[model samples]
Target: MRCEICGKKLVEEPLKIKVDGSIMFTCKECSKFGKIQREAPKPQRPGVSRSSRVTKRIQRPREPTEEVIENYRDIVRQAREKKEWSREELAEKIYEKASVIGRIESGKMVPDLKLAKKIEKLLNVVLIEKTDNDIRDEMGQSKLKGSTIGDIARIKRN
Candidate 1:
């Protein structure tokens, strides 16, 4: 499909989704201006109803369960530990408050899309695995240069 904002091409990948049913359809480069207004459903009326009766169906946005959010936090924390990086080190690398990292790892709070992407890039792991529900960062895709704790250790020696 084409980008809703730039009209550019869109690959078969996920996009960042907001709680209000707003989906970002373009690449991250074009996401800066991909603000599409959410269209509300029109009210419906039953033909059999003689009286003036309008039925409106209100759809609530999807919300991640507490358990699922906690799972994501654990995944991030485990990835960081696998890298043998302390909370302070990760915080410094991601340019976030150590307390924020601590809270996220402990499942005290959920990271916004931007913060989640930052952690994923710095940790070099798919902390937030893609599901039917996830904000895709096409431009922020990163690969571990050489994974494994040994490789990381060797890099520090140089």
Candidate 2:
């Protein structure tokens, strides 16, 4: 038998797994990538085809919620420093990669809702918030003249 993913010849029975909901016979190495999905009994009708019996799946659109607060990097960096925590320490405490913490602190990456929440709790700071305009924008009903989120942010010259 051959592996479905790597196409390697196998001496043992092919591993059965469900990759993105499709059950496939895979090799030992390839099988680690997906969940185990039991094979459904095929219908024995003479004129029925398996492809025709399958239904198309439609997924509902998701709404965008919890945008990063203005000046998130500065806030996070300040909070982390106030507690005398290094970047590695914060990453270790949060169970995330040090690169992720570095990116967030340098404003190179925005923290997702879950990561933001973790950061908020750890640093005692607010990293994300939901606004009426955010909801309206997600629903395709935004009426703001500004094209970007930073349009409303105030810039001060020292």
Candidate 3:
């Protein structure tokens, strides 16, 4: 080990000292600049093993997540038409560009949660739905193969 302040190699045992309210391992010469501190033993649970802790974490329930509906583009378009609002008008109400509205309506782009919520409120349409985490877990368990990186990336992008 090396001294924190001087960066000198420590041939002997390093001292634990408190300098400016921070604990540091310092050489004997540098330790004189700070108050010596007593090293405390780390506390560990008596019966817990690393594998048991991992399994406990894995068994924890996942929270339900929200996702956009498959027919969101059609729903948004029909709702906006029913309200007799132009694309530009709807975009202005949602603080988005007309091009973005056009792309979403044309099914070229998928709106994120925040944008979908804004459009849903303005047009009074249901575009997002909550998916049960337990259902997803069951599906995942039934699949024989693991998800590839591309599949994971696609999930993340959405």
* Native-to-model Cα distance after best TM-score fit, residue 21 in candidate 3, in Å: 51
Q: Which sections of candidate 2 miss by over 4 Å?
A: 1-64, 133-158
Question: Roughly what TM-score does model 3 have, to 2 decimal places?
Answer: 0.47
- Ten consecutive residues with minimal summed lDDT in candidate 2? 149-158
List clashing residue pairs in candidate 3: none
**How are the candidates ranked when ordered by lDDT, highest leading?**
3, 2, 1
Candidate 1 to truth, TM:
0.40
TM-score attained by model 2:
0.44
- For model 1, residues 1-158, the per-residue Cα lDDT tens digits are 77655677877553443424456666556655545323443335455232223331113223422212335576677778878888889999988888988998988888876787787677754434333223223333222222433433443444
Count of backbone clashes, every candidate in sequence: 1, 0, 0
lDDT of each: 0.58, 0.72, 0.75
Score residue 123 of candidate 3 by CA lDDT: 71
Compose the digit string of candidate 3's lDDT tens values, residues 69-125.
787787778778878889999999999999999999999999999999898778766
Q: What is the C-alpha lDDT profile of model 2 across 36-154, one tens digit per residue?
A: 64466444554445532442111222454458877789877887887899999999999999899999989999999899889888976666755434346444345332322332242
